[model samples]
Target: MLRCSHVLCKVDDIAAVVRDYRDLGFTVEWGSAPGRAHNALLWFGSGPFIEFFELPPVFGLLRHPFGLVHGGPAGERLARWARPGEGWRDLALETDDTDLARARSALRTAGLPVSRVIRGRRTRPDGARVRYQYLASRPAGLPFVVSAYDPPQRPARVVHANGARAVARVRMGVAPADRARYAALVGEDRWLSAVPAATTGVLDVELEGLSGPLDPRKLHGALLAAAREERG
Candidate 1:
């Protein structure tokens, strides 16, 4: 089965996001590059991570045919998925060759629109290369089927001021008709529930361990919170 890979959060400015997340007491790893990276990430040493990215007008790139060649069908879908404004825009599901084969077969067996292998790679600030591939299917709400990273990037530090250890769960929201399918594919839990919502996407994200609330105003109404862990 597929697992929650990462939640894509779109921001107007990458620098502000890195700074804000850092201020929130979480280690933010620059995704694109050190000085001019378009994205940054928050890793808690385990589980899924949160990716913050910016999609500013790329000098008339998307409007040109060469851009389409560069991004391909999957890339076009990603660009279209990320609408204007801030907050959680998209979600991804991690899969290995086994899981990908299973998911690929399942989609074909069910007559779903399956995509060709789409690969992408990026360079880190330190000059290390990060690469991965995935498949996209019909229906905009479906998460991308991403492959496991060979050598996943690590943050300079995983330590956080808050007691947040890892992603407790992601409270996902989907169309009522699509909830069951989503639940079946991604599973349901306190954090990763595919509940019914008017809008289809991530409803909120809950990080494990914390007693107080974060300022929603600063978060741009992204609906992220930290709850005290329930010990049995």
Candidate 2:
């Protein structure tokens, strides 16, 4: 089953997002930009890491190819109508199938359309190169997007923030109709829902943080700042 991947916050400072996550006790990591604006990946504790991406092309590449707007409010909008966690976002699965082609076929037969597969370079701190693949093509404003990754040189955790053991859940605000469809996509039995407009941000996810207590407000502010930086 696919689990939540880190939520994307469309921002204008790739660096500030890193700082914000770092301030929250999460280890934020950076790699050389694939191009254009910077992309920062933050590993909060174990397996779940949020990636902040700048630039429209990069964001579009990761999300739904056929974009649509599903909303809770009229005035709030962001880049190509793909606001934070809005639309059919991606959730990754730890599959026995690492070969992307096999996984894509399975998803297609399951009913989720394969949008596109992205192949790129990821680098480690020591400058080692890692081949990266991201799979997508789910419709917009739906509940979940699915992705699979393979690291050619280093482990996926190496380029991404490490420490998170497993993703617990991701909460986002969406129209009631949209939410229901999404829940169905994720398999209703495993997904949860709340009243429409109950939550504020586009997406909210929980990571199995390290032992001890971590404050949600602190993490929220850091995430906001990073989003702002992406804009500026």
Candidate 3:
């Protein structure tokens, strides 16, 4: 079973993007991973967080060993397909198995178009190290799943000014004709939902916000739209 670990929003300037989300009432943090890229993590208590990546100007022109471009070299191929400006670019899934080889095999057997497993690591300012393995697929807009080889300790709870508690659901927009194809890729996950979109990629996300309901689209950027999901 796969659950959303986080969503990756590609942007040019990390600081500006952070400021935008902060104004929306989310607590965004700055961090970088080795030479990969810089990021801002939008914390929503538990469950999944939103990871925004600030890609380098030479990203597309560079030859990334991993094939696709976002997460690492493996994403080079996928990155080439991404457009400029801020928008949802990648969606990561969490899995129980931590073995990279087994994880790759499982996806292949299940018929997902996944690339070879790629290793990645990052060290926090406090000296904490995060290690994980992931596989990127060219299909379905370069979505990937990763298993933590060494997971980081959970951080303290954050008080959201907008009242968002957790991510309720991620709404991805797909071409009308490719709806079934994308749906099959997403499998049968309850938390992740897909709708026919005029364009393909992440349309919007729903969150459990405190100040009633919220949509990221109403905040800014059409690449990702957000809504508040009611909790029982």
Best by lDDT: 1
TM-score of each: 0.82, 0.58, 0.79
The local distance difference test score of model 3 is 0.65
Residue range 41-116, candidate 3, lDDT tens digits: 7776677778877666466555364354333435554454355766677788778766567766766776656777
What lDDT is reached at residue 32 by model 3?
55
Q: Give the candidate number with the greatest TM-score.
A: 1
Which residue runs does candidate 3 get wrong by more than 4 Å?
33-37, 63-65, 68-82, 140-142, 176-181, 210-232
**lDDT on C-alpha atoms for all candidate structures:** 0.69, 0.45, 0.65
TM-score of 3: 0.79
The positional error of residue 35 in candidate 1, measured at the CA in angstroms, is 2.0
Better of 1 and 2 by lDDT: 1
- Model 1 misplaced stretches (Cα beyond 4 Å): 57-76, 98-103, 154-157, 180-184, 187-191, 228-232
lDDT of 1 by residue, 86-191 (tens): 9887788887552366676775676656566666778887888888777775455666678777566655458777667778878777887665556555664334
